[model samples]
Target: MAGTAPGAITVALVDDYDVVVVGVATMLEPYRDRVVVAELDTNEPVKDVVDIALYDSFAQPESDHHEVKTLIDNPHARRVVMYTANFHPDLVAMAQDLGVDGYLSKALNARELVEALESVHAGERVISTPPSKTFANSGDWPGRSEGLTHRESEILALITQGKSNAEVVALTYLKPNTVKSYIRGLYRKIDVESRTQAVLWGVRHGFLPDHRRIDHWRGGP
Candidate 1:
């Protein structure tokens, strides 16, 4: 987390959405002098001494599963945030059990994302949620999906559509806060740490169309 002074914290963004990557990078640009985003992938490997490894929990879970485990296992990668959209309660619990720094949803706003990244990088956990007034019912997501609930599937679907947390909030008509909770749940069930992975996982698992055709945030084509 807070290894040194307020200087560039190495960040790795692992999502499949060019829009998300571009949006996140733009928001982080102001802190470029203090924060450096190394590589952006749907998988892992921005091999340097990275303080924060931010990735999509939904990204190719099978393929990146071992890679993510390896990344988290590395002591050098001190901070880990599972940024994702589609997941189940069990997945979020797993992330907590794994002791990841935090979880983020692409559906979250730029401000929320920056706060989460900064907080995680500083050794704090940032949980993103929409306005409290958005939803009237809060289901016990923990037990909703015996294996993979309908809501979990919906969250994943929105992620593949390139919708931000805010966008998903508006689309689902659920309270922004509820959507955020859904994202958290998804991470635990899928055993991932970020949204980039979520999108990738969707593609790999046939939930989302393969978007490798899009450009990556770190100059990927």
Candidate 2:
């Protein structure tokens, strides 16, 4: 991360919500000399064009990524830097697969954020999640959905081990609705759209526990 530092990396701030837009804009104000920031409208394409588009997640866990996808799909933003809290490795992987130039954290201070921007602008693929954090319930769960809550991770393990929602409920002694909620949360956290994907992701991330012995699991998702 070494550069002579330009006047500023021209950046267009894009976030669906107003408070998020304002909050990020204010955060960048202190770095005014390092980065020139301009806001983008929620509906219209970017009016104040820039060198890169900094899209904020505004602490949406891994939720509401469709908005980020929309930003990536449109051609208005030259380089799409995900200024987000969705730092799960799996989620970050999906973002990279979606062709996000840089994956950053909303929790970062102004200096770290600015450095990330500069690195990203210099043609780097920056996905900042701790690659080692997995679904295993180690004591040091860092943040939301990145490693998942203990129960959610355990449920994800069972789901990957081929447990149905009902079976998971029984295994965890949680109600069916609770199991379903955890399932949905797991899916959203890992950014998987379906059972098969979630299973594969679990396997890929070593998230399996032990499989429950059932004659046969009922019903398919």
Candidate 3:
């Protein structure tokens, strides 16, 4: 569950296996009064009041894409737990990037799954592996250059919105080559390697306005 309020949370389980479904239902029997398993299939829309959701990684790619889209689109779908038989490192990283609350191996017993749910409900990230240690010791880099020109800042803002080079050029009315030059300058000013990383840093340091506010970029006549 995502929220701390016991009465506020509704859980959904989306999986293809009946055995797995039975195991999860058995584990959640204690909280059956509070937790409602909507269904075993991914055909239905995830309810807004649902604070937590679980998905079987073995689900078809189309189902997985839709599930991720649903969770990302729904602001209320804050915590998601993905259970899979395959614990491949790349798959785990992909799950983390999608902002899942927990990634547990399906081979684990119901007790472990229950514990993961409990921890995730408590607002803790319940993933099985530890987060990267490099970030644990890394200090914030003094990378921002106050001397960035206005146009450079504008380019950075567009990049943060995840606009591609061609899109940025169209948005700014700049030539493609000019856009690439601006991006190079942005990377140097921000001390980043790629446009995506530069954009992330810009957003993190408040150099870029919230991407949702892009309409503000078009000035009134």
Best TM-score among the predictions, by candidate number:
2
If scored against the real structure, what TM-score would every candidate get?
0.49, 0.52, 0.46
Q: Tens digits of per-residue lDDT for model 2 on 166-217?
A: 7775545567888888889888888999999988997777554221111011
Q: Which lDDT tens digits does candidate 1 get at residues 3-110?
A: 533566787655544544454567666667667666544553333567787765432341224445655776646787776553445556666666778866656655
| Cα lDDT over the full model 3 | 0.55
Model 3 Cα lDDT, one tens digit per residue, 145-176: 45555456556655665767877665454679
Pairs of colliding residues, candidate 2 = none
**Winner by lDDT:** 2
Error of 3 at 101 (Å): 1.0
Error of 3 at 138 (Å): 39
Once fitted onto the true fold, the runs of candidate 2 whose alpha carbons sit more than 4 angstroms away are 1-6, 41-44, 59-64, 130-221
Worst 10 residues of 2 by lDDT: 212-221
